[model samples]
Each structure stands twice: as structure tokens, then as C-alpha cells.
Target: MKRIWNNSWLQKGLRNSTFMQSKSPHQIDPELSDKLFSIVNDILPPDKQVKPRTGLLTFGDAPFHISQPNQHDTKAEFEHEYQIVTEAMAGLRKLVPLFLTREDADQQRTLDLLRLEFDAKMQQGAPETPIDVAIDLVRSVVADVGGLRASVRIFIDLFRALSERRDELEQQRDKFWNLPHRAPEYYARAIANRLAKLYARKTGQKPTSGASTDTGDASTKFTKALEQIFSLLDIQSGARPPADWAIKNLTEEDLAPRMSVLENLGLGPSPSRKGLSMSRCVLPEGPKD
Candidate 1:
């Protein structure tokens, strides 16, 4: 966050700076200043850049000498510009995680923290999370400077950039998912443990005797754990049945539509009919008993 300075402190700082020491009021070369301004303007986003305006007068469609504001107005304008710069810097700092490389530990930690914060907000039934608030603040800042049209243009540009980088973004997402804690088996084990606790609370009975072994194949262990959970819940009928019944009754034809729905929602990969099967694609294969 930027520190707020009183008018006296700002005046003191200016007095100490070279800007105040210059003998001539216009010590800086106007052409050089204009060139530097143009360079910086070109580098800045459209929403942040200063727009050129017509001078006080024009001759043959060309701008004449530009008019300068009063000293008080110029001071206020400079303070406003300084405030905008500081706020933009603060916002960029908060968004550092988004720009970091996938392998950066800081990026991972920041993302985990954000996810936890988002989950906490959701659990607390918050109307707006911190992320949402930050986004709205940025939109408001852009709109304040360049109006609603600029905000829309900024979002449209962002969407285009994301669309162009979809494949790279997917690869980064896949990398994140491949992390140890994000493994499928890890989630399955977590779900099983939670369900076991819930079952104990509901039935007032201890969980099954033999817990799923960690040494065996992960898929086998996951399957066994799921079986134990289903047994505990006594779900012996309806759409969710035992593995044997599922293998016999459910086919690619039956699951294809659901897979298509997932694909459409961008939750799963594109559904492939050729390699689709109950055991391979839909369910974990293990001993039936």
C-alpha cells in the first residue's frame, strides 16, 4: 500500500528534489519530455494511457498552442495522477501470483492461500469474496478514468488474450493438478475419511475393521476404500450399485451422454467413443469382492 503524505510533507519533498532547484521554470526540454511521454503512453494499456486532446485553438485542422491550467488546478491534477500510479502499483503487487511461472513456490503458496480464502468466504456465505471485491475495484478504477466503454474494452481484450493462450493455460492447469496433494487418489482418500467420520456420527458405529492398504496399487486401494464407504452407507439399490452390477448394466452408450455434458461444461476432456468403457474410463478396476 502507498503511504499518504500531507501537503506540507509533499511540499518539503519537492523542495529537496532537483525539480525545485532548477533556475528556469521550464528547465526540461519540451520535445524530449513529449517523446518520453509518448513512449510511456505507448507502453501503457489503453485504459491507463493519457489521451491526446485538442489545444485551445486550431488552424487548418492542426492544433495551435495548448492552454495551461492555474497553479492550484495543476497541483490537484498532479496529486490525482500520483494517486492513480500508487493504486495501480498496489493492485499489480496483489496480482503478482497470476504473473509468476508455474514452478515458482511463491506462486503455488499464493494460489493455495487464495483458494483457502475463497473457500472460507463461501463457507461463511459471503455475498462477495476478496477476489470479487478486488476485481470490482479494478473495474471501477478503469471506468472512473475512461468510463464504462474502457472497462468493457479491457475485459474484451482480456478474453481475447485468454482465448489465444487456452492451450498454454490448460497445460499449466494440468501441471497444477499433477501436484502430489492434487492426485486423484489423494482426493479419494480424503473423501473416504470424511465419509467415514460422517457415518460414525450418524450410525454411532465404528468404521470397518481393515482400512485400505497404501502399499498396493493406488487405483486398487481407492476402489477398496470406495467400496467400504458404499457398504457403510448401505447403498445397494438405484443408479449407484455395486461394481459388478455397474459393469454389467452401464455401457459406453449409457455414459456417453453424461460424458458429453461434462465436455460441454469444460469439466472433462472431449468424450471419445472408441476407447470408452465402464472399467477403463468410468470406473476403477479391481477385485469384485
Candidate 2:
């Protein structure tokens, strides 16, 4: 009897053979593997670290699986992991401005398109938290790439590259001020004027050039005001507000009275709450096309 080769099996075997030939040595030194793992752990925070599966033989070229902490392991362990995740998300939120001001026009456009998709997802009642949105974005990208591990590896590599070139990235970000996308100087002046007004209102006197005010206290107040403004505008903290909603229109006095009324009614000035109304505050009609 003549033996015939299966076409699909032959193709698959060729592909696998080619892949193996192109890959590095099948086995890695145990010490070297451990050192590599240690380096990765040192580079990434706990939440972003990749863990190797124990009791399994892995080749040098094997893909690494990025796993989330098992929530069912223990309540204390879960809470600890939760805290790390929260801190990671907060750190990510702080990086939003840098992410938005990409030096490459293509990257900036890609991010803008992603934001549009995020907004559409939110409108469809997806979880509105930044963490949830981030997860959704990751899932979408993973799906597009056809492999979670590959997508995660790309992200990890990009993160490591960014960490190594933080200073260069910051310099590039500074150059974004010259771009016509947004006005950073105008916003800086607005924030400074607002802070000065708030300082004067609280102290019943204008701040002098050499006045010795508590720097920490002023910083805390400034942070709170910025948070409140972002919350009221239904935008992220580092994001630019809609052009129609002039920053000049939303004065401290305008919000102060409304905030007091909300406080009296056991509500805060949150865009999410039905109690808060744009009409109550001195805001423009709405964002234009």
C-alpha cells in the first residue's frame, strides 16, 4: 500500500518546523530565567508584572501569560491585589496627559479614535470607571491581535521602553505646547487666576507677592478645585474641556453658591448625579459639532 501525506498536516508541520528553527534555544539556563524574571519584576509594578506558571516546563521562546490575581484565593489576598490594581489605575490616570499629547500624528489620531469608541461604549452603559475602560480597550486590542499573550507582551515591551525614555518623552511632550491642538498657557493662567480668587475669598484679602501662605494647603485646594471642575465638565482630569464651555464663565462664585445648595441637599457637584444641572451653573448651551 502506498502512503499518502495529508496536505493540512504537511503544511502545519512545515509551519511549526519553521517557527522552531527561527526560535532561540529550546532550553534556557535556570539562573538566567530567574534573573530575567527578577528584572521584569523590578521593572514593572506588582499589578503590571508577568508571572511564570510553576510546575510546567517552558521553552526559552514560549509565550508568557499575564494573569490577574485569583479573587477567590483569599479575601485578604484579593483586597491586597485590589489595592495594587487601584494604585495602578490611578497612576495610569496621571499619565493621561502624556498619552494624549503623542509626538506622532498617527498615534494621536489613533488615540482620538479610541476615545470616540470609549465614549460610544459608555453611552451603551459600559462601566464608566477608567479601569473598566482600560480593560475594554485591552480586550479589544487583544481580540484584534488574535492573542492575549502577544498583545500583553507588546504592551509590556512598550511600557519598558517608555520607562527607559521618560525624560525624552517629557521633552517631546513639552514641545506639544507649540501644537495647535490645545492651549496649555491659557489654561495655566485660568487655573492661576481661579486659585488667586479662591485664596482671596478664603483669607478676605488679596494674596501679596511675598505673602507666606501654607504651600501644602494651597496645593490641596488647587487639586480639589481642579478635580471638581473636571467632574462638573464630565471629562477626565487632564482632558481639555469643550471649547464652547468657556473657562471664564465658570467662576468660583458661580460654583460656590451651587455647591453650597447641593451640600445642603446632601448632594455634590457630580455630572453623574441627576440633582446637578448645567443650567444651574453658568455654562454654555452644549458642545458644538
Per-residue lDDT over 197-260 for candidate 2, one digit per residue giving the tens place of the 0 to 100 score: 4443443333322211554221332343443443432334232232213334445553342244
Minimal lDDT window, size 10, model 1: 58-67
Q: How well does candidate 2 score on lDDT at residue 123? A: 40
Model 1, span 118-213: residue lDDT tens:
444333332222423333344335434544334333433443333323433333335333354333332223334433333333334433323325
Question: Model 1, residue 143: what's the lDDT?
Answer: 36
Model 2: residues >4 Å from true position, as ranges?
Answer: 1-95, 126-289
Candidate maximizing lDDT? 2
Look at candidate 2 and tell me the lDDT of residue 160. 37
